[model samples]
Target: MSSSDIFLGETIGTAILILLGGGVCAAVTLKASKARNAGWLAITFGWGFAVLTAVYTSAPLSGAHLNPAVTLALAIKDNGIEWSDVPTYFGGQLLGAMIGAALVWIAYYGQFHAHLTDKEIVGGPGAQATKVKAVEAQEKGAGPVLGIFSTGPEIRVAWQNVATEVIGTIVLVLAVLTQGLNAAGDGLGILGGLVTALVVVGIGLSLGGPTGYAINPARDLGPRIVHALLPLPNKGGSDWGYAWVPVIGPLLGAAIAAGIYNVAFV
Candidate 1:
């Protein structure tokens, strides 16, 4: 694929991914939304559909490597795309993710206001327990709405958080690599995209609890940056300190998956 095609495809695809994916979080978390309290199952399936939609739409152009880890894995595995195109893919994905996140905020502007500005909604009567338990969460650094944009751990142990992200990403990248290495370079065929979407849902259900299953770096960091930047009243901190786990862990996992594919599957 040409550089323009890769950039445009990745940009559009990842934006859609986060829009719908983050939309689900907003719908479930933000008050005044019809789907509020719809819970975790809804989130997993929402993201699955997000992947499926983004992939099918963008596959012809960029092979739908919407996630940076997928791009990194394909690069390391020497998938059909030129290694030089990796930066283009990364740039597109990050920009797209940020766009998507901002869109989510726009789409849910009222809900965000209702949730963020209201102390009752922000912390509620159960605020103390939540702050005590999830010390690295909304009360400390990551705001309550931060989860709508990025991932965070239930437990704040550094190694454990990193390990959870790594393991989840390993599952995700391994599945993508196993779906038949391809010419578009990311190996996501039409069927591959559907299967990968389901695989994402599975990873969420099985492994999302510990660290929220941020198997993609762009998916996490770009949105987190937006969360930090957007002018939301009483939105709290963006949890910059815990940000590296999602980015580094997924990259490491992708690299490891690439090594496995190269050493054993290739």
Candidate 2:
């Protein structure tokens, strides 16, 4: 694929991935939505479907390396792609993730407002509008709706969070690395998409509890950046402190996976 195709394919595919994935979170979390509290099963399956659609749509153009870790692992595996193309893939994935997140905001604008201010209802009688809530202020990371944009840990153990991200990413990147039925660049056909999607669902079901399974750096960071920038009310912190966990952990896991693939699968 040409640089332009790589750029555009990853951009569009990652965008779609985040749009549907994040859209599910928004639908489930935000008040007054039809899918409110649809539960974790819905989220895991929604993300799987999102992966299927995005990968299938963009595979012909760029092999649908929608996740930065996937791109890195594929590049490391030397899947007939040049090292020079890695940066292009990363750029497209990050840009696409941000765009997808913004689109989710637009799609759920009203729902976001209602959810954020639901408790404060109208900001009228005895509202604490002047001062931020103590819980919001004291808690340094993750706000009311931050989950819609990025992952956060349930228990907040640094080592545990990093380990979870690393393990999940290892499984994800390894799947792509070991998948030999299709040409690496093809991600060929819907079968490839189906396998990847099912793997993602499996990972989410088995490994998502700790850190929400942010196995992809662009998927987590780009949307988290959007969360920080958007004008959503009472949106709380963007959790910049924890952001490095997702990014570094996934990259590290990808590297380990690449090393393993070279040693065992090659």
Candidate 3:
């Protein structure tokens, strides 16, 4: 395929991915009014399926990178991809993410506003305890804290999140490279799709608890950028403090995976 076709495919494929993947997040979190809180399993499987779809659609033309970290890893491994194309791929991924995020925002505009009012109060420990009491009182007769999403140390530890992303990406790239080598006959045609689903499912099951398994740099950064740019009521979309980890962690993981795969497996 020509570079132009590859670029277009990557752009469109990534956009669809973010739209479906990120859209699911918005539906579950921001669209609580719609009773659309997709639980952990939903998120995990949704992303797995999204990856499968994206790879199947774009692998023929663009290698289905859809992530800057993946592109960087491939370039480092092959050394044949022109340096000039690196920027193009990254640009397409980011642009696609932004576009996909905008669509998500538009789709969930009403839900965003509805969930904004369900804020958790914060203060000193005593104040927090009191706030919890107040919330409980207000929510009397409602079953225990159902469907309320809260960020806590166990779930949001920075180091843990970064580590999980790194490991997840490493496993993802290793799987891709391995499948690329051994695929046979019609199986070769489906290898990309299968690997895409498997990697995401593995990450979701193994590493998702810490960082939500944002193993793709473009996947995290693009949606976050859109979250900031889009006017969603009370949506703190751009959590800048944690953003760099997803980008840097995945790149580091991919590089390490490539090196290890080459030295040990290849």
Candidate 4:
């Protein structure tokens, strides 16, 4: 595919991916939505379908590869995606992710307001906004609004969170490299995309609790940036301090997967 095709395809695909994926989060998290409190099963399945849709739609054009880590792993695996083309993929994915996240905010605008202002929302059940206020008084950061847009640790242990991301990403990239059967440039065929989507669901169900399973760098960072920038009432801090974990961990996992593929699969 041409550079333009790669860029546009990834941009469009990743946008759709994040639109549906982030949309699911909004539906489940935001108060007053029909899907409110729908729980984690819906989210995992929503993400799986999102991946299935995006991958098939973009495969013919840019070979999908919506995740930067996926692109890096494919390049490392000698999958015909050149180092020179990496920037195109990264640019498209990040741009698309931001757009998708913004769209999620727009779609759930009222719900977001309601959720943020609700008596008990931020610190989980039975915890009031006043409690969050006290925490914010003592803590330097605002109550985290980025959870709607990005991932975070349940326990706040840096090493554990990073390991969760790395291990999850390794599962994701290794599945893509080995299980996806399409011959296109790091892209899956229809069946392979479906299979890969199921793998994503499985990962979410099994491994998502710790760090919310941010197996893709762009999936976390792009939306996190949007979460930081978008103006909303009491949207809270973006937690820039913890942002590097998702990015670095996923890249490390991708590299490890690529090395393993080269050593064992090749």
Candidate 5:
């Protein structure tokens, strides 16, 4: 594809991916939304549909590599996607992610406020445990809104978090590389996109407990940046400390997947 087509397709595709994906988080988490407390099954399926929509819409133009890690993996393979096009893919995905995150904020402005302001009784009947937990969290300076924008580990073990991401991304990129291996394997055919979407849902449902299955660096980083920049009321710290795990782990996972594919499958 031409550079302009690559850029425009990736930009638009990643934006839609994030809009629907992140929009589901807002729907389930933010207070007062109709889908509030909808649970993880809803999120997994929502993200699956988001991937289905974005890939089908952009495959003709850019092959719908909406994540930078996916772009990097495809480049490492002998796929026709040129190394020179890497920056275009990255640029489009990052910009698209930011736009999608901003749209989610705009769409759920009220719900965000309600969520951030929500607090249990600090010194009431359940005060002892609640107050201690709140104080500990205050020292960490992390906020609840961060989950809506990006992933965080349930347990803060670094290697474990990184391992979770790496394993999940291996499943994802491997699927992308090997799926629909007929005449249409050059890009996602209609069936390929649907199957890819289901793979994403499977990843989320199985591996999302630890770090929310970020599999895509742009999907995590762009929205985290927006979470930091947006003028939301009482939005908490963006947790810059733990950000590197998601970015590095997925890139590593993609690279490993590419190496394996080149050795065994190619």
Candidate 6:
């Protein structure tokens, strides 16, 4: 692939990844009234589907390493990747993630407003009721009771979340690469999809309780950047201090996987 194509593929692939992956989170979390607390299962399947689609869409062109950790792992494993391509791939992944996150923000703008307003409404039900009573007394009209979506474990620390992301992503990449190798020459065909999906499901079931199982640096950082940039109401902190975990953890995991695969299989 030409440099331009690779660049564009990375950018577009990351965008699609975040849009589908993060969009599902926003749909389940942010748009509580409509999509209230869809939970981890939804996120797992969403990510799995997002990855499957993104790979199918861009693999023919750029190999669809939307996550920087994946790119780094591939570069390390296969000497064919040039050193210079590292920067291009990383840049494209980050940029693509940001674009995809922005798209998710746009898609969920209205839901965010509704969610916040609903919170305020539920906070002072008595006062709101009194106002509605007054309005009803005045013959103006009866006010409506708006229900807001709520979730548990609201405050998440940067370190803790990053730790979760790293652990999750490492497992995810390791599974993908390992199963991919096993399936490659064995005529696994679409069984590759089942392998990928099972890996995500296992991670989600076992490791997703914390940090929401980010597992993909591009997946977390890209959307986090958008969360920082977008004018969404009540946007949470960026947690930049722990950002390196997802980045570093995945790389370490990939390296370990590579080492293990080399020693065990070779």
lDDT of 4 by residue, 72-122 (tens): 898898655789999999999999999989999999989888887776655
Q: How many pairs of residues collide in each model?
A: 1, 0, 0, 0, 0, 1
Better of 1 and 2 by lDDT: 1
Would you list the rank order by TM-score, best first? 1, 4, 5, 2, 3, 6
lDDT (tens digit, per residue) of candidate 1 on 1-266: 78999999999999999999999999999878999999999999999999999998898888899988988888888544568988999999999999999999999999999887664555556576654544545555877789999988888899988888888888888888887345444548877888899999999999999888999999999999999999998787898999999999999999998898888887
Model 4: how far residue 97 lies from native, Å:
0.3
User: Each candidate: RMSD to true structure?
Assistant: 2.1, 3.0, 6.4, 2.6, 2.3, 8.7
Better of 4 and 5 by lDDT: 4
Off by over 4 Å in 2: 78-80, 120-138, 184-189
User: Between candidates 2 and 3, which one is better according to lDDT?
Assistant: 2
Q: Tell me, by TM-score, which candidate is best.
A: 1
Q: Give me the displacement of residue 140 in model 1, in angstroms.
A: 2.9
TM-score of 5: 0.92
TM-score result, candidate 3: 0.80
Q: Model 5, which residues run further than 4 Å from truth?
A: 121-135, 180-186
- Model 6's lDDT to the true fold? 0.61
Q: Which one is best on lDDT?
A: 1
User: Over 4 Å off in model 3, which ranges?
Assistant: 31-35, 117-157, 181-189
Tens-place lDDT per residue, model 6, 1-266, is 66777778889877887788777777766544366578778777887787777766665557666777766665665433565787888888888888887787678777776754664422356467745543442342111211011011123465565556656666766665666532222111244445765776788778866545556667666666666566645434454555565566666666665555456654
* Backbone clashes in model 1, listed as residue pairs: 138-142
Q: Where's the lowest-lDDT run of ten residues in candidate 4? A: 136-145
Model 1 scores a TM of 0.93
lDDT of 3 by residue, 64-116 (tens): 77877777766766443566778878888888877777777677666666655
lDDT of each: 0.88, 0.86, 0.66, 0.86, 0.85, 0.61
